[model samples]
Target: MVELAETVSDVARSEDRKEFDALVQRYHKQAYNIAYRMAGNHADAEDLTQEAFIRAFRFFGQYRRELPFDSWLYKIMSNVFIDRLRRKPKAMIRSLDQPVVTSEGEAQFDVPDNSAGPEETVLSREMDSRIQAALDTLPEAFRLTVIYADIEGMSYEEIAESTSTNIGTVRSRLHRGRRLLRNKLKSYANQLV
Candidate 1:
């Protein structure tokens, strides 16, 4: 990644379109994933990701080379998402079959046991729905914190850098976010049974 970053930095400094394209190719999928988590749907996620790249390109000259590119991109994406939310906040209703796009390929939430009964499938879906709903209820700060820390598997320090906040703030937000999620999910625990 260090070599890749250095190459990207060099290309970006030279203002070469091809080099920029390489940078985009390297990070677009991850950007889309972050946007997908924030937007909660593919269409909006695509739009947000595109907008983030456009903004990143437009402001590439202003980007500090010392900072991690992904962190810088994530900051742009986070701001884009926040602006969109302010303009129009909408509920996310994801289909059960929606394939989550990942580097490995598309994946979906599934029962571990292939022979799982219909009842088990239904229960799994319900649980997933409940958890998503609970997540949706959180404030953007808390939601993004949880998404970055847990869903995206980013470390607390990475999250802090991406969010432009100190590690202490990141930890606090994560703790508060998880507590809220736990409380929200507890209410639906009996329904899953």
Candidate 2:
């Protein structure tokens, strides 16, 4: 990574396109999700993700291999996506009303039939939808930190490094972000009861 980071300013960095390609292959999904987590829509995610990789390659020399390469890449992707999103402030709010897209084309959430009435079943599903919406409503930085640390299963140190934030801020953001999400979710909690 030290060598890679040096590549950023060192005019004579490694010219091995294959090596960089390999790195891309390894992190494509990770990068895409960070974009998705930041940008929300698949179309925007695709564009932002591609642009991030392009930017990374353009600045590959700055990559410090001593640090985690994945973290650096994620930071780049998150920043790019968030920046693009920042340009379209209205888009983010409009996206909240967008439909949920579940992977595998099937619902993973099961409304346990613990005597759930038809109304209860519907309410449960609505709550689930609202939770997803609230998550999307969160600010990009807070959302990405929480998604990486919780949904994507990254550690605090990893998240902090990726976001260029300190561990304490990472923890604080995660806590506050979830708290805000819960508050948003509470608006629909009556449906749960």
Candidate 3:
């Protein structure tokens, strides 16, 4: 594993044509998952992941060697995601009548849902949607903190490092974020019972 990392590092440092491509192959899914959680949709997640990689490649020369590369990539992704949120228009204008098409020339919206219809699956999806809505209500810092620490299963130190904050701040954000979420979800819980 160390040798593989060293080889990747050497390749990246030498600015080989395949450096970014190799990175994409290794970390694209991880980046996309983070983006998906942040953006709350597949299309936006794909766009965000692509944009983040572009930015990372552009600034690759300045990347610190001391940090884990994945963490560094995630920092770039988080920054790009935040910038997009800031600059995004309050509303977008698009024709709803347009057909959605995939890269394979297939109608995107025509895909069939073949998943199991178990009672647990239905309840889980409902709960997930409600929780995601509650998460969206948080301030960006708290939201990201909660997602990184709780959903992504990152340690407190990792969350702090990823967010460029101290561990105490990470703990504070998680505590406050969870409190807010619990309060927001209380009504839904009552209904469930």
Candidate 4:
């Protein structure tokens, strides 16, 4: 019945356990996706979200009254992601070596296939798989921009703030990231044909 902003602000100001729990209940799943976008993996996403909440809870007292709580929470999430990135050893995206294949007509990555000849149905699945895989190749900043704008349907300004980048950077990253994805998909379009 309560709006997320009010609930979060109250909990932050008062340390209201019930209100805070409601905030968690409402935002947990959505927060997970944000973390996943930033972290680029399931395991890391979970950790990032949990860490964000822990950090946010610890400092809820300091949350400003006029600011939207989700934005504040998201700011905390950004810190968590940056910290995770700094702490972990940077590694190449793990999906590039894998062949994107699927029984369905859609796929995430387009790997060179020796399937002899795949039917339209097979190709569709492969394309879908290749698309997803190609997406995973992007850097966390670019990846979060794409997911927030395209998948979550946030505005450029919202994504820029959530990502701690300027709108120009968000636009540039989204444009460049999508181009890179399309090129990745183009590699296996022959399979679709």
Candidate 5:
């Protein structure tokens, strides 16, 4: 198989949309997974992934071949995710029981109850939700570090490059993040018992 760097070079030199699309096809699912973990929802994850690819396409010429393409792409995605968070205003919290007046009529938020699933499935989902909630409580820097290292299984060097930080910082953040997650999960386990 042809190397991805060669494909990147082809796109960079020729501005070939086809080559870029191939690259996108190869990495889209992984990118979306990262975005979903970062954004905490499907809609925001989709938007983040789209924006990241758009930016990557716009700046393909500047990509250095010495580094891996996925790491570079991830860097761009992380920046886009962080930028979106910075720009978005804090959302106003509303009760699900409260009714909203719409053009047609009044409507209340319909929250899904996943408690009706099979016992094992419900337990698995509950654990996943608890873990995600713990991740959400982390600061962005630590959260990104944990996601890249633990969730994505990226190497320390790759994470350092992706986050534009030294390996020491990545290690520190990962350690602290994992510690926080352990504590939170332990607390949740205790509550359940």
Candidate 6:
């Protein structure tokens, strides 16, 4: 197999779509996983992943080979996710009693009950939800740090490069994020008990 750096050089030198496609094939799943964690939904994750790759291709000339390709790619992904978040409007809360207006007529929202699963499955899902909720509560920097370090298993140096921050900043954010999550999860456990 050609080394990743060589493939990147090929693409960079000639704007080779084939080499870039090969790079995408190699990193697609990892990139999507990061996107899903960042976006918190499948649809948005897919869009974010696609946008990141598109931007990466467009800006491939700016990429420095000294940095790891994955880290550089993740930096692009993070920027895209953050940019989308900034542009997104705050979510509006709607009362269940209120009827939704449609072009044809007024319509009632159908809310599904997700609590009908087996006890073990329900508990597991609830735990995952609580963890995700805790993660969501964090500031974007801390959240991304936690996700990159813990969930994606990126090293401190890699995370620093990805986030465009120093290693000390990454360490601080990870520590603070983990502390907040621990406190939040402890409270949730108490509620369950």
Number of colliding residue pairs in each model: 0, 8, 0, 20, 0, 0
Tens digits of lDDT, candidate 4, 49-100: 9998889878766767587778778778767776786688865664544655
In candidate 2, what are the lDDT values of residues 1-193, reduced to their tens digit? Answer: 8977676635554564566899989988877766665665677778998999898888886777687777778778767866877787556343334555677574334323323367645444545556656778888788888788876798998888777889999999999998998788775656645
Model 6 gets an lDDT of 0.78
Better of 3 and 6 by lDDT: 6
lDDT of 5 by residue, 126-164 (tens): 566667667767777788889999779999988998888
Runs of candidate 1 exceeding 4 Å displacement: 1-14, 92-127, 187-193
Instruction: Name the TM-score of candidate 1.
Output: 0.67
Candidate RMSDs in order: 10.4, 9.4, 8.7, 9.5, 7.0, 7.3
The TM-scores of all predictions, comma-separated, are 0.67, 0.67, 0.70, 0.65, 0.72, 0.70
Off by over 4 Å in 3: 1-15, 64-66, 90-123, 190-193
- Among all candidates shown, the one with the greatest TM-score: 5
Task: For candidate 1, list the clashing residue pairs, or say none.
Answer: none
Count of clashes in candidate 6: 0
TM-score of 4: 0.65
lDDT of each: 0.78, 0.73, 0.75, 0.73, 0.79, 0.78
4 or 5, which is superior by lDDT?
5
Candidate 4, run of 10 with poorest lDDT: 114-123
Clashes of 4: 20
For candidate 3, the 10 contiguous residues with the lowest summed lDDT are 89-98
